[model samples]
Target: MAAQYDAVIVGAGFGGMGAAIQLHRLGHRRLLILEREDDLGGTWHVNRYPGLAVDIPSATYSYSFEPNPHWSRLFAPGAELKQYAEHVAEKYGLRPHMRFGTVVTGAHWVEEESHWRVAIAGGDSVTATYLCTATGFLSQPKVPDIEGIEDFGGKVIHTTAWDDDYDLTGKRAAIIGTGATAVQLIPEVAKVAADLTVYQRTPIWVSPKPDYRIPPRLRRLFARIPLAQKVVRAVGSGLLELLMISGVVHYRRLRIANRIAERYCRAHLFRQVRDPELRRKLTPDYSFGCKRPTFSNTYFRAFTKPHVHLETSRIERVEEQAIVTADGRRTEIDVLLLATGFNLWDVNFPAIEIIGRDGKNLGKWWRENRFQAYEGVTVPGFPNLVSLNSPYSYSGLSYFTTIECQMQHIDRLFRAMRARNAKVFEVSQQANDRFLELMRDKVGDSVFALGQCATANSYYFNQHGEATLLRPTSTRNAQREAVRFPLSDYTYA
Candidate 1:
């Protein structure tokens, strides 16, 4: 017999935790949170590499309702984020509902019972009236498909599963991929490795990171007066929103702002690297905001070090202990580190198999038709299911903004369901289509549509060459619509 739950939230990260908290507030106490990993914190727990830190300011990276006043730095380290996740879980009593080390293979909607049948890795299963998949966008690790990689007789590690026991001191290391993860890691690897080689396929735009340790006095003040912390949070959120709005979302209208941002990034790189050739190799050819940009003060400087070398040639193959370039240059290394990003369009779009009404596969439907969700939460056929990491779901620069906005949407939705005394609620196809059309119109003027992004090789562009990952609106607008969306958009029974 399968255990029954009022709601089953997948992935015990902040998204899932937020969903659980909101559901509890809606009087859905019979809940379960299933996590594949051994613990919570999601990326923060999985990624423990050196120089791991949040790219956004700490003030805006947390939940708006529960702010942490004791962040050690402006951009807090990954460990502090994990600690904060633990703190939130404990404070909200979410730990009791979490089941770690539980892998969810798939889920299917049981129309007769008006519930979801969630299949676990083993033979066990659970039934829930409502299903919410909060599995993050970057949960799946992408192993590179390099030829002869298995023949390499050296230590290999991916950024997602970093081995802390192995020492990098004096080791010759070669890293593949120069994405945002590599931006944070390359500097730390250069400091210890006797020889470090960074292979770049696409150069990422990196602005100057204004990172600094917060003083104890400021921490005390925040703890004593919550309003002071709220003021700082508002300032941080405002700056990030301004960047997103002027530089990316409104690129067609604010081309000058985008160009200015690109020039600022170039200046940051020029200040660190004196060599013109190196500067050229580091600079991105595409327009700024085509892909997600990161903040780092030391990434460009790391290449200027004597021990670090940047390789621009494409990798031809991997030998036993050396990497062969397209130009026939072979570089020997003692360790291979892969900073390759996730497979978002392929395996990560749904994260797990989801079957809605009439045997409609969510992943297949998105790939066959289009990737979209109503207000980035519910699908027309998927009743009582909320996908936190759906298409056009990510709002603003900070992920917490998206999470909170979705939380508000869920709260409003459940309240309406309760008022109607409905056991089943699903988004109408008309509403989903209307929202999709609105998003398409909104993104039509953005950088991905108007600017040159063909050379970016960004994850933002999915398989269909559509940038459907981010919501093409301001965070305030997203939040406003989350609360003010027409209740008639959904069919309640």
Candidate 2:
């Protein structure tokens, strides 16, 4: 079967869904979504790991336009979130526009016509004038490099891509890596697993989630008086802004936040782990903000369980029935779990080479000269291509805020092109270069570059060793910067 559309969106996450809903509302009727999973929720659909839930308040995490004041709790569980995404799709009647269980492996731009020839398996193709890569940052799972991984006889699970049939009850489990996923899983798994050994490469600073069930009456009140919830969100967002403000100015507030986090961690450490030697070993050496700060309601208490063991030694390798640490200690377990997080800065679309004007391959161009996008959506050589959660656009606030801004900018970009009967709309090389110059010079000095962070493997930094991806900034500030590169900044041929 052959199909055509004005735009092709990849991945069905918050970014892709936001694009679809907004574009459909804006009168782009012929749009198609390619999703690898059978379900509508991208990350939420896949990660069925135990005790998975959002850290942010449920009221603020949703779409601002389609507010769901019916959240059951302050932070929603994964199942609730999955159902929420499905509900949004149903409400917007977006199912017919989606193609589920289809994996898009590659895409290329046909230079003359300026259309994207997206290639998928089974010798299928769909050509569209505009391509939107909404494959969000967390879609790809990153398993760490471990020796003798194949030798583990018991079932192995990755938190990002989980197996629902994995039964942890009465099982001795050796969990590797203590990132966000591990923090959530530890408490749940400790309840059932006979013995739980959590391998921590470095300790992470965590705060009480302050989460609770939102009663129906309160939810109804939120729906009616959304301003109250909005104010709460604003206040929380403002608190986060201090980190960016201080980091941007190289002020002492950065140190203040760091000291506060350190003190909190110490309090928790002494409160939970009574052994001074273990507490010292578990303490982190780097600053708190350098890593993605983890929030948990019961993560610290989970460590206090008698059945739970905290292993600090780096894993040497896996044997048939045990995990061998560097100290030659063997931790025998019935299952091994990987809580290693996602590949943050990895480009989602890399299989197909895109050739633009001057016949430059996209990958080669990006490698030779770093990815240059005006507002991190439109590229200099590529015409009519818009990406979501794209490079350099990862804000500290909600993704909905950023995507809506990008979509609005894209709409303006295309409107400008249509008004002028432009054959191609590509950012001028000067505009692209200037954007990168601002990114590295003006923006990279923020708290996102916490060189003193404990979790040193964060994907926020790019190849140039600069933190250009995730940062703390207000929606107004981000949109202002994004909308600054007016459609006129791009050469419309």
Candidate 3:
């Protein structure tokens, strides 16, 4: 018999697991999860760099329903996070429904039957009524297009797809791009490598993590008083929210705070660096909040090490044994690490080949696109398909809140599927267009639009210089939508 499911979830990350768990609790079966990797934990499984850690505090970073009490660190490491995803899968008995190592390369909408025909890389196709794409932003590595890269006689690795075989124990290392990955990785690389060099194009604002471990005594107390831990989590989440609210509402205040942070960083961080010009080279020219702010206690101080060298020259090309800069300089390395982030926007729409009404390819249709969703999950025309962290739905806020928010809207679409007994559901195109305009207009008023930050070329911006990648909706507003998905704005097909 053909495997027909109510929904087919792609990727076994927290988003997919959460969707499956919610459906199971709602008593909906006929669900299958397809994961490309041999394991779960989408980003967590892939990113195994030395200094990888969660940007958000782990207290509120987890699912609200199944909070882990035994989190060893405040900002959990990659391994711990991967374990968290697996634990959730096991705890909810979600493992049975998944087919690991199966990649759903393409999903075609069968308009005649109103079902999605999903194609696995090395297996038979499956038909699903609904398709959920959770292939996260960080899944694909953004290796820069530099000439002579293939000729380099060094072990090259992207932070997204780490090559664990290469031993960096005593080798000279070079890390390209000083973004989020570099912020965490530099300190760790400094510890192991005989000598390390960080090649830079830009600098990111570094802030203190305030990260600490969960003491066993505190864990015991929390175990005894569950509500107390919940209270603590709530308080921690509230503090994070307060920070977000202040940053969003008052752009200037956020800018000033970033400047203060930069000053603090220079005084406490860069002051110890003996070379004044080198210290200046390390400072960022863009507004701190323009690009994503990174947190690390030792990222700046890593430069103070005698073994670590910070290079500011533009990488002209890669040679067999060395990197050639624009000024005819060569920096040799035994291993090279690309801290560059994944490709955004281009990954969505046409890349997935989502052909909607009348053979319309989604990517081509929106040449002047603005990321808009009626509820941050559903698009006007693309019905029965929900994005995990779709546009205007993502924020620098906790992924926990954003994922939960998206899931709520998705639940509404699910309910509508049941309530009307409808074969397919889609957002009205007119509604999406208007919402898209509103999203662009709203974001145009923000600091990111002013180009005061380093995000000018970062994935943070869409072609129109708007940040449609992340959901900027406040948590308070999103929770209301999640509690009950609003169906009024969307038209059922």
Of the candidates numbered 1 and 2, which has the greater TM-score value? 1
Error of 2 at 181 (Å): 1.0
Q: Pick the lDDT winner.
A: 1
Across 212-330, the per-residue lDDT of candidate 3 in tens digits comes to 98899987887787787788789888876555433542454454544555576566545455678777887777754566666678888888888998888888999988888899988
- Inter-residue clash pairs, candidate 1: none
Q: Please report the TM-score between candidate 2 and the true structure.
A: 0.92
lDDT of 2 by residue, 253-288 (tens): 355756665577678667777777767766777666
Question: Candidate 1 on 293-393: residue-level lDDT in tens?
Answer: 99999999999998899999999999999999999999999999999989998998799999999999999999987999999999989998999999999
Candidate 1, superposed: residue stretches over 4 Å from native? 1-3
Candidate 3, overall lDDT? 0.74
Ranking by TM-score: 1, 3, 2
Overall lDDT per candidate, in order of appearance: 0.94, 0.74, 0.74
User: At residue 60, what lDDT does model 1 achieve?
Assistant: 94
Candidate 1 overall lDDT versus native: 0.94
Error of 3 at 36 (Å): 0.9
